[model samples]
Target: MTGAEAVGSGNLVMGRCVIAGKSACVLYDSKATHSFVSESYVQRLGLPVCELQCDLVVSTPASGLELEVILGMDWLSANRILIVCCEKSLLFPNSEEPELLSSHDVMKELQNGAQCFLIFTHLVVEGEGMICVIPVVQEFEDVK
Candidate 1:
């Protein structure tokens, strides 16, 4: 399922993902209404983490000059997306991919008319769970 469907259905995405040779599934709960990652996950992913329960950052898109976004964990979680009436697909750029972006970067891309697929995520940080909007890269990939 797409991130929107998962969030609307009030479900969590749990499955095994092989990261750095460790078998771990990304367990994402959209109902939490907040997004966060375990310190371990953050460390493993090598993404900058904030100590505050909730935080926002504004970043410029690498591909554009006039966009910025309030990036949070929810915005960072998706992996792929389908747009254009599901006839077209887009991959969520990893840091190495040069297309993966922070919230601000995404906003810039949107403002510039570089459209493919998009999802908005809002994260509420509490307990030990994290909520995120996921992009569907493969048709059969599981979101819950």
Candidate 2:
């Protein structure tokens, strides 16, 4: 998308969400099994921190990180919702690989803090493979 277009409609799944009475830009990841809040933001807002049963080491371009307050399975179950995913209404929100993660249950495991990081995943461009993880939070307006 062009810079102007991105500034205009924004991208898929980007929307306004209220976290701890503050306006937070939230992105809905259909693949993400957990919802995460920024640790620093949490600290700033003084949100309650709860101990997890285990640590959550996440894979990212920066190697790895262990989080503290991951709003995972419980959060998703609590917020059973389907807000906005993509801009186009013609496109279906559900994935074509419905059975892929049906019984999979957990798609990601994070101990607690999921402030934000980049993970390198494979993408095909004209039959050629590319390694990239676009940091949309930095690109979008007021995503903190």
Candidate 3:
């Protein structure tokens, strides 16, 4: 199946939310089991974005010591939830493979402080790929 089809199947299976605005289309991949936002759409938003195939496996903190994560529109949709608390760590259950993680984990991590230095190591690309970094908060009050 194609990427879009896989996304559709994943949504059907997981019952995740879909966020499609005039500028973007995002969905959760229940099968490949990763959240994704259309690269093309994100580009239109005037942000420098890059994508490596799921199999490509490009990661930050090549040392495997620093916490790493992949974030995009689809991830935001299912995880639009938020938790306002102090002291927490982000759990990446899907970090190993292609499984959806609980939004609760996202909320806790964001609230507790996830600002750590990141170094992306990509075999195919020259040097480490460091994109723009932005701090995010998942407020439960705004997830309608």
Candidate 4:
């Protein structure tokens, strides 16, 4: 069902995707630049893996996982399947309409000006270049 029909449910996009002749539930997350597959899922494919040195790094969980296939930026770029989605249904962007930026993209204009590092963040600037910087850290040693 589309988002219009499924409102109360979270903003997760669920769809059936055919990969290697297998249909699987594909969750679209714009924030996630990379894709991943569980070991159990790939194991079902029964494809022999080639032994190659890969610098691809994934954050280690508390417990080590024996198997996981991650589709990184390289994979996404190579497979040019554009996912156009909004609050409603997902589709491909037409010639007339342009695709909006993904959640991972920088949407707003950020101020690059250097603000003096003070005790805390969000310091209010006073009139005419006046700032009172305070030390957040204190230097004191406790003897046991």
Query: Against the hidden reference, what TM-scores do the models get?
Result: 0.25, 0.38, 0.24, 0.37
Worst 10 residues of 3 by lDDT: 60-69
Compare the candidates by lDDT and give the number of the best one: 4
TM for candidate 1 is 0.25
**lDDT over C-alpha atoms for residue 144 of model 3:** 62
User: lDDT tens digits, residues 1-144, model 2?
Assistant: 443444355443444556667766444444456767767668867879998999997531111222223344445455554444344212223444333222223224223432223443764557556756666554656656
Tens-place lDDT per residue, model 1, 1-144, is: 544554355333344446656555354333333444445655766767546686666221112211111223454345332122233222345456445578798788889998646554764679878766767666665669
State which candidate, 2 or 3, has the greater lDDT. 2
Candidate 3 local lDDT, 1-144, one digit each (tens): 443554444322222222343422222222334544444545555557765566654322113211122343355346653222232212333335543435676566668995333343533545677755556576657556
Of candidate 2, the 10-residue stretch with the lowest lDDT total is 60-69
Listed per candidate, the RMSD to the true structure in angstroms reads: 21.9, 18.9, 21.8, 14.4
* lDDT, residue 1, model 1: 51
lDDT (0-100) at residue 42 of candidate 2?
81
Model 3 / residue 14 / CA error / Å = 10
Order of candidate numbers by lDDT, starting with the best: 4, 2, 1, 3
Task: Provide the lDDT at 142 for model 3.
Answer: 57
lDDT of 3 at 67: 15
lDDT of 4 at 9: 53
TM-score of 2: 0.38
User: In angstroms, how far off is 139's CA in candidate 3?
Assistant: 37
lDDT of each: 0.46, 0.47, 0.39, 0.50
